[model samples]
Target: MPRLPDDFDDDTDGFDPDHPLADQPALAAVARFARMLETIPWFSRVGDRLDADDRAAAEDYLSALGFPGAAVVPVGDWYEAADCAEALDMHSLSWEEEEHLRAVAHETALEITDEEALDVALSHVAHQAASLVGPAAVLSMRVGGLDDEALARAAAGYAVQACHQAALVLAAGLGAEHPFALKFRLYERGRWPVSITGESFNLF
Candidate 1:
């Protein structure tokens, strides 16, 4: 796993208190992910492009982390458990989905020690890494003149790897015993986090 930069926790360098997203935990999480990418050596290579070795390394690393396979739960089951009911309503989930999310949230809260830390780590993986790295990989493949098949492979591999990297980065800061690390292992194996104490909600 890569170590975060020494200045990783220094949020005052260019911070603007009045910025709209400054106070938003979700945005802060995303910003942290970006900074990780910018400062970490592994992500520096990833930013250039994900190649065969990168894919292989990701597979080996995730396997070591016990990434058994895709989670048994459907992708939709990993709904965000936000702090506010109003934020939950924004998803427009069906009654069954809403109930299921709440149930999962309740279960997760019982299982984990620090839901907030887990939420931040999940935000880094699902929101920042999956959303950003996958598309970026696809574009990089295109730019490299790879074909559609290669492009698809690169995108999937890099995205999954990026998620693993995000989790590991958090682990570096929060300690390996933290929920961030444990939940990430569960996430990789498909035991998705259903709830967290925050305004940010994960839909996919």
Candidate 2:
């Protein structure tokens, strides 16, 4: 019964609270994307760390987006979707690039014992990789461009990096160790890859 601003379109004529503005196509697209992200299995695990109020708020936000159920999906299925491939910009890499990235990842992973250390290392490696030849040098290893040995090394490298990054975030007061699967999503969004074989990125 309350009035919405000029920015919002009335929902009665088919109102969608999640996307009250009909003109902002990008926001509408983000609403859809958020729906997909909420369905990711690890999202709930991440949500479990939230306080009751935060959890309730998250649920309300998702419900408003028209995804009241927000069911979780298998990691593989979600990662393999056509949209994911597009989002990931799946690609291949040369053996030389793979080797270089693996070596860098190996060195960084060796000294990291916790998430904070790992995050700093991840940043350093990403910066170095970017300076070399952009993200493809490392991201290629996640999209089917490396041999088994190379891929293993690549995955290990990124896994450690992701674990560390997630740790830092959790310690910053979330009070939980994030699962590797969830961290993997964060990694990809940051342009880091999970594997060259489209497998789940796990630390163990």
Candidate 3:
């Protein structure tokens, strides 16, 4: 639940915090890319602490090659609602899904008790997993004209993938293991279109 800076969403006259960095084009580009990567759950939660050290190493390496004075600047929390909206658009998610994800992101961001955060996040993951199953079944049926047994396998596979993605995101955000992560890990070594019912089927 990383909160963007207070001024980040204030779009009065298009004031962007990182806009001034344009004066230093190279650093500005690096900063923009770095900040975007930092928005990734695992990186922001667990990997960000090493950013300064990584930068120092990069500078040292550059200086060894006769390049010097590569300054590192603090990018701060620059993620915004617009950024989330755009990401949802890229994923082809509905507006309702976008809003729900945003809420889940914010909830994970709060500095609340660990138990509370884990509880809430896990519940969200459960609901998301359940919601994916029917859509998965429907899509497989429509596109492949699969029978019930094959449809079930396709649906289960879809649910597993969706849950895995959600679990990874929430787990990184919470800095803890998610139930869906465990489920996905167990199935990771298995073939795709895993069986949901007792029937064997080929996805082909």
Which lDDT tens digits does candidate 2 get at residues 43-153? 122112234543343334234323346432223322242233243323533223334434543454444334444445345434443333223333343454333444334
Off by over 4 Å in 3: 1-113, 149-154, 157-165, 173-204
Best by TM-score: 1
Clash pairs detected, candidate 2 = 11-15, 142-195
How many pairs of residues collide in each model?
Answer: 1, 2, 2
Clashing pairs in 3: 1-108, 1-109
Candidate 2 worst ten-residue window by lDDT: 1-10
lDDT of 1 by residue, 1-204 (tens): 223232235334565778654544333433555455433221113223334543343334333333434222212210111122223343443224434433453344335334565555555555545554455545544554544554344344534543554444433333343323333333333222332213222212
lDDT of 3 at 126: 47
Model 2: lDDT to the true structure:
0.33
Candidates' C-alpha lDDT: 0.38, 0.33, 0.34
Model 2 residue runs over 4 Å out of place are 1-87, 90-147, 177-204
Q: Model 3, 131-204: lDDT tens per residue?
A: 54445444544443334554354445455444434443333333212323222322221212121111211111
Query: All predictions: root-mean-square deviation over Cα?
Result: 13.6, 19.3, 19.9
